[model samples]
Target chain A: MQLEEQTITIDGQKIPFQSGQTIMDAALAAKIYIPHLCYHPEFKPHGSCRLCTVMVNGRYESACTMPSVAGQEILNNTKELNENRRALTQMLFVEGNHICPGCPKTGNCQLQAVAYYVGMLSSHYQHFYPYRDLDPSHPDYVVDFNRCILCELCVRASRDVDKKNIFAISGRGIKAHLIINSPSGKLEDTDFAVGDKAAFVCPVGAILRKRTRYTTPIGERLYDKQSIRIVGDSQQLHAGATKYGRK
Target chain B: MIESLEGKRGVPRNRPPFPVTQGYLNKPTVVNNVETFALAARIAVYGGDGFAALGTKQSKGTKLLSISGDCLRPGIYEFPFGVSVREVLEACNAQDTQAVQISGAAGTCLSAKEFDRKIAFEDVATGGSVMIFNRQRDLLEVVRNFAHFFVHESCGFCTPCRVGTSLLKNLVEKVYTNHGTADDLKDMSYISQVLKTASHCGLGQTASNHIADTLKKFPEIYHKRLLVEANFEPAFDLDSALEDARQITGRKDEMAYL
Candidate 1:
């Protein structure tokens, strides 16, 4: 039996999709950008960052997890949605110590790129500045908890792709922190290698190569040349094709 | 789409794969409030029009209010929608009702001037709580209590709520203790705006409800308590440190050695 094609209207644009494709998947395939932080095309949509929330019909729903139904009206790129996105970015900044000036991933960071895309000038909320410890025990890499956004990308990559199960989130609420599953509770004690997907999956400067700091000049980095939107759109285009094993 | 059990922290899940389509072990499910179920039962017994005839166009059927504080008769009162705040106060024998906290801590704190506002979806939408405060009671104290409650109840899921509640609590206490500066007041408003728009769930989103509403409705209460004469002040006071030194030296003279 031939499958019927479906299309959804997002921000007044008609985007076509397969039967079970999510809004995010279809939008990415169409090269329509929806700013998101926790959503990596490689992993399952976590829906935790909430940066991808869009109005469906009249109700709010996260586009990352919501499936695309035929003729579904989705409102994205609106003032209300962007304003909310900017506020969420500010909250991420103030929630932890996201000091961008001295960070290694200054130009390549997804959080910073998305913040710039959403036009977040400053962290409008009060800074928590909760003291979190850093772990440099790993010979090749370091784990700086301060810059962590709790996106759980590393956690997912470590468990699913790497199959090491080295990283896990422990505690709840403000006390929640990324933990190592080893006996010593440190990355050095765990079996996490430098080449593992978890090490390279951190969207922020939290996980870094020990000696690669400032290797790429500030103005010559990934996001420094092209905006995250352009890079993300191209990346999504490739991700969409690869998902269905298409060229 | 699994329902969070009662007594657990009330953070909402992200929608899209909403409970209706994918919920509870990935099976299709329906989630409803207990009150909604009760209302459905009522509608089932009485025809839809019979229940719809009771309330305003926007808000249909009677609402159950949990009334308390400074009222002669404090208990559950069921009244149809579109009832004025003043009318509810009169029915409950509320004394000198300076303010009414409609819908618990996360709800709006309506001032005496807003008594004319009706309890409807178009006006003041409440979730059953109605706390009446007399003129003698301190509004700041009530706001402080609310701040503490949010701090204690925060689920720490996202950054905005986990640390935001504690910061809000500290700011409220700073204002309550008469150490608030003009900057503190500015920060309070800014934080409230951020929490309202950013937080992961309704709890953090409305965590600043009491502070924001009280600040707008009764500015004098907060303005009068501010001790700082300048636009800003350090987190600590040096004068308090000098007083501590004086007590340690057992010296009553003006010259305790500067």
Candidate 2:
């Protein structure tokens, strides 16, 4: 006996998927763009960012975690869904101090790219502008909490791939934040190395290597030339660059 | 047990690999609501059908309602499901009831016109809270209170709920303070739609329930509060802040900006 091939329709486009694959995985495989953050291909689907929420059979579900069922009708890229995504992206911009113009990762950042893709022109809501401390104690890298979107990619990469267990997310809700695992509560005190997968996993400028801030000109960057949709995968750009210690 | 070990924020986790499959310490666990346990205990004594026969087919068993506000007798009332809102109000001896808020702040706020609606899984579902409002009661004030409650309770994990709650609170308060415009009311409804569809959790999703329900049922209350001028007014009044400084310096001159 052979297993049956299954297909799901997304925004009138029929896409095939194997069993145990999520909608996000199937969509990405078919080159269908679904705006998302905190959903790196290499890491587990952390549904903290609700950007990829799509209507499935008249109900909303995060495409990153929701498994694709055969003959399932999904509504993506609709006016209502995109409007909601824009509002959610705007909330992310205001929740933290996301000053894209001043940040070093303005052009290359996934959050910035996703915001642009979603057409988030401004933070519609008032900015929280919470004061977060910047940790530059690590000899080889710096962890700027201000830019952290709490995607937990570094946490997953450090624990799952690097086996360093140097990063963990602490707190709940808006108070949720990234914390260093070492006793001194600093990245330098932890066993994290510059070559660890965690260092290169951050989709934003939150985690940056030392002495390589302005190496790449603003215009000549990854996302500057092409949007995140053209790049296909967020983790791909920084995948082989880990050994060189630059994003 | 998951929340007990994970701390008391009461936020739920994603499903598929539910707590029953892989939970605390990567071990299987059983999670149930407190009411479920109580229902189980009652079922052991009364039998399944005995408890089930009391209410509607879809929603069996009795419901515990926490009714308060303008009702003459405001307290807990246990009644079988499928009871009408008017029947509940009559039982509680409610006087001059204008509206009923079912299921706490996140529930629907029904006007007197909807009192005939029954309480059941098939009808108006509730999680055991019903607040009565008299005709003299201000609906905007009720909405303002519910808005503030959500703002205080928001865990701030996701963007929609965290920021949306604050935005709802400000908009509701703007109407309450009589500085609201028609655009503000429109923005509130739009924000509510965004919260319901995009929020990460149920709290953010339902935070706008009271505001939305009231806006639909009682648009006049909001329109009455709208400023006559068509000009946009900021949420905050700068002149109010100057009142404190004016009093401290005791300046009555025109330059003092009084």
TM-scores for chain A over all candidates: 0.92, 0.93
Which regions in candidate 2 have their CA more than 4 angstroms from the true location?
A1-3, A181-184, A241-247, B1-11, B19-30, B228-231, B235-258
TM-score of 1: 0.79
Residue A205 C-alpha lDDT in model 1 = 85
Give candidate 2's error at residue A81 in angstroms: 1.1
Please provide, for model 2 over B43-158, each residue's C-alpha lDDT reduced to its tens digit, 9 standing for 90 to 100: 99878988988999999989989888887788888999999999999999998888899998998899999999999999999999999999998888888888888888876666
For candidate 2 chain B, which ten residues in a row score worst on lDDT? B1-10
Report, to 2 decimal places, the DockQ of model 2.
Answer: 0.50
Docking class of 1: acceptable
How much is the lDDT of residue B137 in candidate 1? 93
TM per candidate:
0.79, 0.88
Predicted candidate 1 versus true structure: per-residue lDDT over B44-88, tens digit per residue: 987799889987999999898889999999999999999999999
For all candidates in order, state the fraction of native interface contacts they contain.
0.42, 0.58
> Model 2 chain A, poorest ten-residue lDDT window?
A238-247
